[model samples]
Target chain A: MEIFIALLKGLLPVAYLICLWFYGQLFFSADETKQSRWAKLSVAIAVCMHTALLFSLAAQYHRCPLWTQGEALLFLAWMLAIVHLLSEWSADTRRLGFFTLGPAAFCATVALSFLGKELMLDAQYRSSWFIFHIVASLAAYAAFSLAAVLAALYLTLHRKLKLKTFDLTFRKLPPLDKLDKLSAMWSFLGTLLMLASTVIGVWWVRRDGLHGMSPREIGIFVVLAIFLFTAAARRTLGWRGRRHAIWILAGFAALVLANLAGLHGFHF
Target chain B: MILNAPSQPQVFVLGANHLTASVSLRDRLLLDEKSIQEFAETLLKDGVVKELSILSTCNRSEIYGMAEDPKAARTHIENAWAARRNVSEDEIRTHGYFLSETEAIRHLFRVMGSLDSMVLGEMQILGQVKDSYQLASQNGWTDFYLNHIFQSGFHTGKRIHSETTIHEGAVSISYAAVELARKVLGDLRGRVVGVVGAGEMGELAAQHLHKAGARSFLFFNRSMGPAERMAAAFGGESRLLSELQEHMGQCDIVISATGAPDIVITREHVQGALRHRHGRPLFLVDIAAPRDIDPLVGEIENTFLFTIDDLKNAVSGNLELRRQEAHKAEAIVEEEAARIESWSRALGVVPVLRTLREKYQAITDREIEKWAAGQPPELRTHLESLGRGLLNKFLHAPTTRLKQLGEQGDGSRASYYADLLFALAREEKQHGD
Candidate 1:
């Protein structure tokens, strides 16, 4: 059972790499009419494999896959893949897949390496509320990560346009305005999820009479505040383009740092 | 350079194009769709050409045909074209060029692939070719030879279109604006495009943007009459020059092509529009000769500005890239033309092989009848089937070798050798004839 689980976990990144390669071909190649079907199929295959791996891991451990840091990393990667697929379908922007899948593959690889060393299951593994909180937080992180990726793409394209390069990368990227809008959209969703996760965490803390805030909680609060400010500024002050994209990237960086510190046993 | 023998049907093409004739002469020699159909039918019905298709575009007029007597067919086409257009035969002879056999095959491929077009790598020639071929096919004027050439031509065109960057970028000034807008703004649906000056360039730019999926347009001119006229033409609203800044905020793309001696759109105008735009970028194109928009407006945040020189530079670059890609496309045409020629050559031996097979079957049938004379009815039928099967098996090896020789362009000599070896009697008439 352990061998099978490890094998499935190891295969996760390979699936994502294949999916990425197909999307890369679809974007870089001039003929998209034929490569699109294979790209979509590859995404479906990767998503299905990741879903099966998560469920099998959950069954093997006889608990939700949100308890340990490694398992949570795996879940986060799965959520990112799900979010990418959903966005690709809803947005009609398949070219963004090449950008998003790279990180998903990298995260899965990291989780595989970490799992090989040890599975650091937390003490609050049995708490259902804690599981929900972790799930929401990771989901928010996934959304923020996607938003940052989009922002980076927007900046790259914007610079290329201003400079008038008109190179292959310039041709392959979605329009600057579309990228900006999609980045804002993902940031808005991430902020809402982060708020929900923060609220759940506070409620659980109060009910259980836990101690003061952890560093991870404070970091989430800061990231949440940045996104909220971004959403507010765009609405009230008309903040856009480079400033908006930079704000999203900074917020994502903060979120990543906070998660890393929290995983290292940093407390309030 | 003919791939087939002297006795085989030869492919021929005769035409005059932009390089060979002036616009006046080309226009005078023009054949419309109805006339092209009539012309093809007349030639096919009169036995002047075995198979025929005619392509008549504004830039060129050409006839592609297969005939046993290519010189006669060429002469007939020349006289007929001159008579129809009321032009002298001397005029036709002065402007026209004729190609036969392999030269004709290569010319057709190059035309379909757009390598021979006035604008290298233009895409309309392929569609024109397909239309011509379809007309011929519908009227039963074309057969296996013409069909093979057209199908191969289309394949080559498709390969060049997709595998190379020949048609990747805009080559004209007006279209460059639309291409730039698409790159900056992505899909232009639901986007408002503003046109200024009501000049020809502005109208052309607006037309391109409309085709690129922009629905709403606002035209601003110095006079209200031309603005309204342009607005009515594009289903857009007309605004005065005074309201340019007021309505500029609502526009995602603005094309300025006025004949004003000084800059009509200042930096302050763009700044005012940007304040009301709420973060959405603006694309501004200045196609005026004395430049209507301020060059400094390009420095403003969230505003992309292009002048006539910039558009020209983009177009020239794109054209250069297409020229490079044309070389690659020419290579593809050469390869595909050779392939079709080989396939056509292989068809020459098919008749000889069929006749040989028939002779063998006749001898086998005679022997089977004598052997089964005393057998039962069921047994006789089985014996006849078995003898025919053996005959086919015996001929299969030689048939494969003969096709190989034909495809290698030695078909006529191979057919003669097969006839001598088989001692088969020649038929008085070919199957289709």
Candidate 2:
């Protein structure tokens, strides 16, 4: 069983490579939007392999595989893959897979490197409150990451329009208004999840009287504040275009910082 | 089965354009709406062609049809067009080029792509082509062959434009005016366009703007008659030029193209219009030679003023870009035309396949019935199965080979199959003899 888990973990990268090959075909084909079967199939297969790997890890740990912060990374990657499939199904856009799945594959690979460490399962992790807090926080991170990618694309299209440079790539991207709306939708959802997670964390702290605020807590508050400010700007300042995209990028930076800084048990 | 001769292509097109004929001659040969219907009926009655459509524009006049005798049909159209325009046969011969079969299909595709227009990448040709097609359709002049050809032409035209950057910029001055309005206000579906002046340029600009999806229109001229005429033409309301300022406040775009020697639209009136506009952007296109609108109106906030010179400069800049894009369009046209030609060539194999199937089925049915006569029910079933299997076995080689020949562009293979079908039936009959 151990060897099988290891082999499956190793196959994730191979699956990503196959997906990349199919993605290149979809991106480069002149007129085959309705014929991207290989890309879809490879993504579905990669997602299945990742799911099996997660289940195997859960079996070994005797818990939901997300007991430690490192395990949360794998859950986040799974959310990324699932979100990408959902976006494709909803938007009918194949171009987004490379952006979404490329980061997902990278995160999964990083999670695999952390497999030799202890699972860190304890009584506190078994509590439903801690589980919801961690899972919701990671899911929000996934949403913000998707928003950041869309914001970056919006800025690229904005730059191209300002420069008056038209090309096939420019033509293939979603319309500017649609991109702005999608990015805003994702940011709004992310902000709601982040607020919910923060509320849960505060309740936990009050109930247990744990360690005081740390750098990771500050990072989370700052990220949450940035997104709330962006939401306010949309109505008050009529914020859109370059300014809106920049706000999402800034929030994404804070999200990355929080993930890196949250370690010493003083963090959410 | 009566199979069509393989070498005589059915579809043909004959036309003279700005490239082939003088503008005066093209103008004389132009067919109006009623004349188009008349000519369609006349050509169908001539018996030389079974299908007909006349695409008459200021730049060109062309006839598209399906003909029994492609060459004779070409001459018949040439003679008819000459008689209608009161020109001589020698004149039509000198000016017109007759296109048959693949050339006709290729030429239609090129025309649809605007590669054959006077100005490269002009979009009006597409609308004119569609109108001609619709006219032909309504008159019942379009048969299956013409229908397929026109539909394919429309699809190929759309594919070329979308896949290539051929139609990147506006090529005409009037359309350039509309494009300028659209650049500031994306999607002009709900926008109001006010045409101030009844000049030819103003009318043309309004027509193009309306086609681009501007819903509301206001026509203003010093004379009420001209204003009403313009209003009736564009499906809009007419307001006297004296009352232009009162109505200008409601318009999103104002086109100034009056024949007045002085400025017809002043800065003060435009600035006042901006006040009522509530910061919404206003586009002013002053396409008069003597300069109709005040250029100072451009300095006002939220107002874009473009004059005749600005439009001219825009046209020149876009013309260079269009020239470059037209190169890509040429390759696209060539590729798609070849694709359409290949389709028509494949059409040639249809009758051959039909004839082969019918002839073999008849031979198998007759032979099986004769052999099964006076036999028991079990023996008859077995004999019928044997005949069916033998027919399939016999046809497997030739039908596959014929389809392969069609794919390989072997025209004579169709004729060869034609002869072989007859010879095989005859040989089977002789064996029975």
Candidate 3:
């Protein structure tokens, strides 16, 4: 099991390294559509490889890898890569591969580096309900990461545009309003999914009397609250541009901290 | 001595442009397409220039051709311009820039590549050159040399176009408007562009918008006839100017260039359109001097408004950017010109090289028959091989060196080598005959 985990972890960075090269070409190369299309193709291949690795680990453990530390990290990176692919397709921005894949590579490297340290998970995690809830929560975090990357891009392009220095820089990005709309849409979907997952996990914890609600659970709820507030304010108070972008960032930041600290109480 | 040697019938070009001649002179020299063809026929008939092509745009008029008596051709062109424009021949000569041989070739190359155009890296000149070449070809004026020159010029232009970013950005006001639309709307495919007014600026804006991939175009003008005509040109429909309110909601963009003294589209009309659009972004471009759209309409959310001044600023910025690219394109033009000049110089010696090889083969065949007379079949084959191989090896060095000198564009040295080779061939012919 350790050998399998180690091999998969090793393969993850190799895929990421190839993806990084393609991302550089996509961002720094000419404005030809073919180059970006190939870059997106490489990213898709990497995601597929990561997915195959996750399935192998799942087959080895005889359950979903969600309960373990290294496997959970790997799953988060996998989800992030998929979300990034979604963004690349939806936004049609050739310059985004570097920003999107740079973060995914970091997540994957950290995930792969920390592999084989997963303590054998309990049979309780074998339940499909608990698996679905955790998967939902991780996917939410993935969507949030995609949203945060787009928000940062929006802010950067907005600054460049305001300065009237928009020659070749940020030329491939979607328009400001288009970026904002996408960010908001992703944030809404992420937040809604996170809330649904949180409710499911909380109900499971209570019904099974597994344990008390951890601070990680409360932290996720807080992130969800921020996302909901931002959505409501954008409609009601016309909160837009930097304010909404910042709100999404803060929520994603909270999720990151909670994930890295392993404060969701499944840690060994 | 100069009269004893024949002069080659070489291509020469003489021209005046906005740079050298005033607008009035250029206007008088303007030969439209059909007239330019007729002028070419006249030049051919007059026997001043053997082959002729006329390129006359609004800003420049250049007559390029192969001339048997180039001095007479220059005098004829000057006298013709003087007589036609009622100006002195000396005055016409002073205004024109005359070029022959290498300089003429380079100038035509640069013209085709648009390095010599008023707008740097402009694409219109390529088409114009192609048209000129086509006219000359159809009229049986162009020979192999002129055809080769034009085809090479076109290929060079195409290479420079793809290799440089010369044509990447928008440099004119109409194109700048399209750039702004693309910047704001990502891709304008499937979007509707509403053009209000039948003015030239409005028509140009609509045309640019159509080129930028706006699927549907709505033309609203007080003058119905021109509006429908513009709509027909764009493959779109036209409506009355008063119906802008109804059409505004469907349009992703609005370009207004009406000649009204007062504001035509007020804030109220835009607000109503905004309510119906469901908060999709709408780009409004007002190009009229007296301001067709109200300034207050710009304050509405999801409505981005720009004026004629804004477009001018964009045009200046984009033009400056293309100017930088033009510098890079100039380097490409210089390199291509040098390369073409080398090939042009080499073209003179092709017939001489062919005659030299034929002469060598004749001598070798005669020697082989004499040396292998009454020998066995194997000995005869050996003699033939020995003679042919020696002849090829003996000829190789001189052949390579002369080709090198030919491509170096030393016309006198290449001509001297050709004369020397022909003399040797004539000496060998005496022995064979």
Model 3 fnat value = 0.14
Per-candidate TM-score against the hidden true structure: 0.88, 0.72, 0.70
Interface root-mean-square deviation, each candidate: 1.9, 5.9, 4.3
Q: State which candidate has the highest lDDT.
A: 1
Q: What DockQ does every candidate get?
A: 0.51, 0.14, 0.19
True contacts kept of 2: 0.02
> Where does candidate 1 stray beyond 4 Å?
A1-15, A41-45, A64-66, A204-212, A264-268, B1-6, B88-90, B213-215, B356-401, B410-433
Q: For candidate 3, lDDT tens digit of each residue in A1-268? A: 6676567678778888888887776666543455566686788788877988888877886767777676677888888888887777777654677877777788788877667675766765567788879789888988888889889987776665444444665455667777888899999989888988988987876766677556776777778888999889878776776678888899889877766555456522
lDDT of 2 at B43: 75
TM-score (C-alpha, index-matched) for candidate 2: 0.72
CA deviation > 4 Å runs, candidate 3: A1-92, A95-101, A104-148, A154-166, A170-258, B1-11, B22-24, B32-53, B66-92, B137-140, B172-175, B187-251, B254-273, B286-300, B348-405, B408-433
- The whole-model C-alpha lDDT of candidate 2 against the native structure comes to 0.78
Q: Candidate 3: lDDT of B291? A: 94
Model 2 residue runs over 4 Å out of place are A1-63, A68-71, A81-123, A157-182, A237-241, B1-7, B32-34, B44-46, B50-53, B66-69, B118-155, B168-359, B374-386, B406-422, B425-433
| A1-268 per-residue lDDT for model 2 (tens digits) | 8998889988987897788778766665443433377798899999999899889988986778887655878888888888778778876557766766777888887877776585566464457788788878888888898888888887776565444444445545665555666788888889999999999988876776566777888899999999999888865665765678899999999889987895636423
RMSD of each: 4.1, 6.6, 6.9
